[model samples]
Target: SQQGEEDPQALSIQEGENATMNCSYKTSINNLQWYRQNSGRGLVHLILIRSNEREKHSGRLRVTLDTSKKSSSLLITASRAADTASYFCATPISNFGNEKLTFGTGTRLTIIP
Candidate 1:
Protein backbone atom coordinates (compact mmCIF):
# COMPACT_ATOMS: atom_id res chain seq x y z
CA SER A 1 0.00 0.00 0.00
CA GLN A 2 1.36 3.39 -0.91
CA GLN A 3 1.54 5.46 2.22
CA GLY A 4 2.54 8.90 1.02
CA GLU A 5 2.47 10.91 -2.19
CA GLU A 6 3.59 14.41 -3.10
CA ASP A 7 1.36 16.89 -4.83
CA PRO A 8 2.38 18.68 -8.02
CA GLN A 9 4.49 16.44 -10.15
CA ALA A 10 6.71 19.40 -11.04
CA LEU A 11 7.52 22.93 -9.96
CA SER A 12 9.54 25.81 -11.43
CA ILE A 13 10.75 28.78 -9.45
CA GLN A 14 13.08 31.71 -9.87
CA GLU A 15 16.27 31.85 -7.91
CA GLY A 16 15.90 33.62 -4.54
CA GLU A 17 12.20 32.95 -4.61
CA ASN A 18 10.40 30.50 -2.41
CA ALA A 19 9.22 26.99 -3.25
CA THR A 20 6.62 24.87 -1.56
CA MET A 21 5.68 21.23 -1.92
CA ASN A 22 3.04 19.09 -0.27
CA CYS A 23 2.56 15.47 0.73
CA SER A 24 -0.44 13.45 1.80
CA TYR A 25 -0.53 10.07 3.42
CA LYS A 26 -3.08 7.31 3.88
CA THR A 27 -2.43 6.17 7.42
CA SER A 28 -1.00 7.16 10.74
CA ILE A 29 2.75 7.67 10.84
CA ASN A 30 5.20 8.01 13.64
CA ASN A 31 7.17 10.50 11.62
CA LEU A 32 7.61 11.72 8.09
CA GLN A 33 10.85 12.39 6.26
CA TRP A 34 11.64 14.62 3.33
CA TYR A 35 14.45 13.90 0.89
CA ARG A 36 16.16 15.56 -2.06
CA GLN A 37 17.95 14.09 -5.02
CA ASN A 38 19.92 15.74 -7.76
CA SER A 39 19.84 14.30 -11.25
CA GLY A 40 21.30 10.81 -11.30
CA ARG A 41 22.25 11.06 -7.65
CA GLY A 42 21.17 9.28 -4.48
CA LEU A 43 18.57 10.76 -2.21
CA VAL A 44 19.66 12.92 0.70
CA HIS A 45 17.68 13.24 3.89
CA LEU A 46 16.28 16.73 4.35
CA ILE A 47 14.08 16.95 7.42
CA LEU A 48 11.97 14.74 9.62
CA ILE A 49 8.96 15.85 11.59
CA ARG A 50 7.30 13.68 14.17
CA SER A 51 3.59 13.16 14.48
CA ASN A 52 3.68 15.13 17.71
CA GLU A 53 5.31 18.08 15.99
CA ARG A 54 3.53 20.62 13.87
CA GLU A 55 6.54 22.29 12.29
CA LYS A 56 10.29 22.04 11.98
CA HIS A 57 13.11 24.03 10.40
CA SER A 58 16.52 23.24 9.04
CA GLY A 59 18.63 25.82 7.29
CA ARG A 60 16.46 27.38 4.59
CA LEU A 61 14.01 24.51 4.74
CA ARG A 62 10.81 24.59 6.73
CA VAL A 63 8.52 21.60 7.13
CA THR A 64 5.05 21.42 8.57
CA LEU A 65 3.16 18.28 9.41
CA ASP A 66 -0.54 18.04 10.12
CA THR A 67 -1.18 14.56 11.41
CA SER A 68 -4.84 15.24 11.85
CA LYS A 69 -5.12 15.88 8.17
CA LYS A 70 -2.52 13.27 7.27
CA SER A 71 -0.60 15.80 5.27
CA SER A 72 2.71 17.65 5.29
CA SER A 73 4.31 20.55 3.48
CA LEU A 74 7.85 21.62 2.78
CA LEU A 75 8.93 25.16 2.13
CA ILE A 76 12.24 26.31 0.80
CA THR A 77 13.07 29.96 1.28
CA ALA A 78 15.55 31.89 -0.88
CA SER A 79 15.64 29.16 -3.44
CA ARG A 80 18.85 28.83 -5.43
CA ALA A 81 19.91 27.12 -8.60
CA ALA A 82 21.69 24.51 -6.57
CA ASP A 83 18.34 23.65 -5.01
CA THR A 84 17.07 22.26 -8.26
CA ALA A 85 16.24 18.66 -7.56
CA SER A 86 13.50 16.11 -7.00
CA TYR A 87 11.88 16.09 -3.62
CA PHE A 88 10.24 13.09 -2.00
CA CYS A 89 8.32 12.39 1.17
CA ALA A 90 8.68 9.13 3.02
CA THR A 91 6.93 7.35 5.83
CA PRO A 92 7.74 4.23 7.74
CA ILE A 93 5.26 1.40 7.36
CA SER A 94 4.87 -1.90 9.04
CA ASN A 95 4.26 -4.82 6.74
CA PHE A 96 3.87 -8.22 8.33
CA GLY A 97 6.36 -8.05 11.15
CA ASN A 98 8.94 -5.82 9.47
CA GLU A 99 9.11 -2.10 9.03
CA LYS A 100 10.25 -0.26 5.90
CA LEU A 101 10.14 3.18 4.45
CA THR A 102 7.83 4.00 1.58
CA PHE A 103 8.66 7.00 -0.59
CA GLY A 104 6.34 9.20 -2.54
CA THR A 105 6.39 9.63 -6.31
CA GLY A 106 8.37 12.89 -6.01
CA THR A 107 8.19 16.44 -7.22
CA ARG A 108 10.71 17.75 -9.75
CA LEU A 109 11.69 21.31 -8.89
CA THR A 110 13.60 23.52 -11.30
CA ILE A 111 15.18 26.73 -10.15
CA ILE A 112 15.62 29.32 -12.87
CA PRO A 113 18.81 31.26 -12.45
Candidate 2:
Protein backbone atom coordinates (compact mmCIF):
# COMPACT_ATOMS: atom_id res chain seq x y z
CA SER A 1 0.00 0.00 0.00
CA GLN A 2 1.08 3.56 -0.66
CA GLN A 3 2.20 5.45 2.40
CA GLY A 4 0.41 8.71 1.73
CA GLU A 5 -2.78 10.06 0.20
CA GLU A 6 -3.96 13.61 -0.32
CA ASP A 7 -7.64 14.44 -0.23
CA PRO A 8 -9.58 16.54 -2.72
CA GLN A 9 -7.68 15.23 -5.73
CA ALA A 10 -8.35 18.62 -7.24
CA LEU A 11 -8.81 22.12 -5.86
CA SER A 12 -9.72 25.38 -7.54
CA ILE A 13 -9.47 28.81 -6.01
CA GLN A 14 -9.44 32.45 -7.02
CA GLU A 15 -6.38 34.60 -6.81
CA GLY A 16 -5.49 35.86 -3.33
CA GLU A 17 -7.53 33.14 -1.65
CA ASN A 18 -6.20 30.59 0.75
CA ALA A 19 -5.78 26.87 0.11
CA THR A 20 -5.54 23.95 2.43
CA MET A 21 -4.88 20.27 1.83
CA ASN A 22 -4.92 17.17 4.00
CA CYS A 23 -2.70 14.13 3.80
CA SER A 24 -3.16 10.77 5.40
CA TYR A 25 -0.66 7.98 5.61
CA LYS A 26 -0.08 4.55 6.98
CA THR A 27 2.91 3.23 8.99
CA SER A 28 5.47 5.14 10.99
CA ILE A 29 7.83 7.66 9.47
CA ASN A 30 10.83 9.61 10.66
CA ASN A 31 9.76 12.70 8.78
CA LEU A 32 7.40 14.06 6.18
CA GLN A 33 8.11 16.64 3.51
CA TRP A 34 5.98 18.82 1.29
CA TYR A 35 6.83 19.52 -2.31
CA ARG A 36 5.45 21.66 -5.12
CA GLN A 37 5.67 20.83 -8.81
CA ASN A 38 5.03 23.13 -11.74
CA SER A 39 4.30 21.87 -15.18
CA GLY A 40 7.29 20.15 -16.75
CA ARG A 41 9.43 20.97 -13.77
CA GLY A 42 10.91 18.96 -10.93
CA LEU A 43 9.32 19.09 -7.52
CA VAL A 44 10.73 21.63 -5.10
CA HIS A 45 10.91 21.00 -1.39
CA LEU A 46 8.62 23.35 0.47
CA ILE A 47 8.95 22.17 4.06
CA LEU A 48 9.96 19.22 6.16
CA ILE A 49 8.27 18.58 9.48
CA ARG A 50 9.61 15.86 11.69
CA SER A 51 7.46 13.46 13.68
CA ASN A 52 8.33 15.29 16.86
CA GLU A 53 7.13 18.55 15.37
CA ARG A 54 3.48 19.47 15.57
CA GLU A 55 3.64 22.58 13.45
CA LYS A 56 6.03 24.35 11.10
CA HIS A 57 5.82 27.42 8.92
CA SER A 58 7.76 28.75 5.95
CA GLY A 59 6.82 31.97 4.27
CA ARG A 60 3.14 31.62 3.32
CA LEU A 61 3.09 27.92 4.11
CA ARG A 62 2.07 26.25 7.33
CA VAL A 63 2.18 22.53 8.10
CA THR A 64 0.79 20.57 10.99
CA LEU A 65 1.35 16.98 11.92
CA ASP A 66 -0.61 14.56 14.08
CA THR A 67 1.57 11.58 14.72
CA SER A 68 -1.15 9.79 16.62
CA LYS A 69 -3.29 9.65 13.52
CA LYS A 70 -0.47 9.48 11.01
CA SER A 71 -1.84 12.51 9.25
CA SER A 72 -0.74 15.99 8.31
CA SER A 73 -2.17 19.20 6.93
CA LEU A 74 -0.85 22.02 4.83
CA LEU A 75 -2.17 25.56 4.83
CA ILE A 76 -1.25 28.20 2.34
CA THR A 77 -2.14 31.77 3.09
CA ALA A 78 -2.58 34.41 0.41
CA SER A 79 -2.58 32.18 -2.60
CA ARG A 80 -1.61 33.35 -6.05
CA ALA A 81 -1.92 31.99 -9.56
CA ALA A 82 1.73 31.16 -9.30
CA ASP A 83 0.71 28.69 -6.65
CA THR A 84 -1.12 26.71 -9.28
CA ALA A 85 0.57 23.35 -9.27
CA SER A 86 0.50 19.84 -7.86
CA TYR A 87 1.33 19.40 -4.19
CA PHE A 88 2.71 16.16 -2.82
CA CYS A 89 3.62 14.81 0.57
CA ALA A 90 6.36 12.29 1.15
CA THR A 91 6.92 10.06 4.13
CA PRO A 92 10.48 8.99 4.66
CA ILE A 93 11.05 5.57 6.10
CA SER A 94 11.79 5.64 9.78
CA ASN A 95 15.18 4.03 10.22
CA PHE A 96 18.82 4.89 10.34
CA GLY A 97 20.41 4.96 6.90
CA ASN A 98 16.96 4.87 5.28
CA GLU A 99 16.75 6.98 2.16
CA LYS A 100 13.48 6.17 0.47
CA LEU A 101 10.35 8.30 0.52
CA THR A 102 6.85 7.31 -0.46
CA PHE A 103 4.84 10.00 -2.26
CA GLY A 104 1.14 10.69 -2.50
CA THR A 105 -0.79 10.93 -5.73
CA GLY A 106 -0.92 14.68 -5.09
CA THR A 107 -3.55 17.39 -5.23
CA ARG A 108 -3.78 19.51 -8.30
CA LEU A 109 -4.39 23.07 -7.18
CA THR A 110 -5.64 25.69 -9.59
CA ILE A 111 -5.56 29.40 -8.89
CA ILE A 112 -7.55 31.64 -11.18
CA PRO A 113 -5.72 34.28 -13.13
Which model scores highest in TM-score?
1
lDDT per residue as tens, model 2, 1-113 = 75699987999999888999999999887789999999859999999999899999999999999999999999999999899999999987645886788899799999997
TM-score of 1: 0.95
lDDT of 1 by residue, 4-86 (tens): 77888899989999999999999989999999999969999999999999999999999999998999999999999999999
**lDDT for 86 (candidate 1):** 97
Number of backbone collisions per candidate: 0, 0
* lDDT of every predicted structure (CA atoms): 0.94, 0.91
**Candidate of highest lDDT:** 1
Local error of candidate 2 at residue 67 (angstroms): 0.6
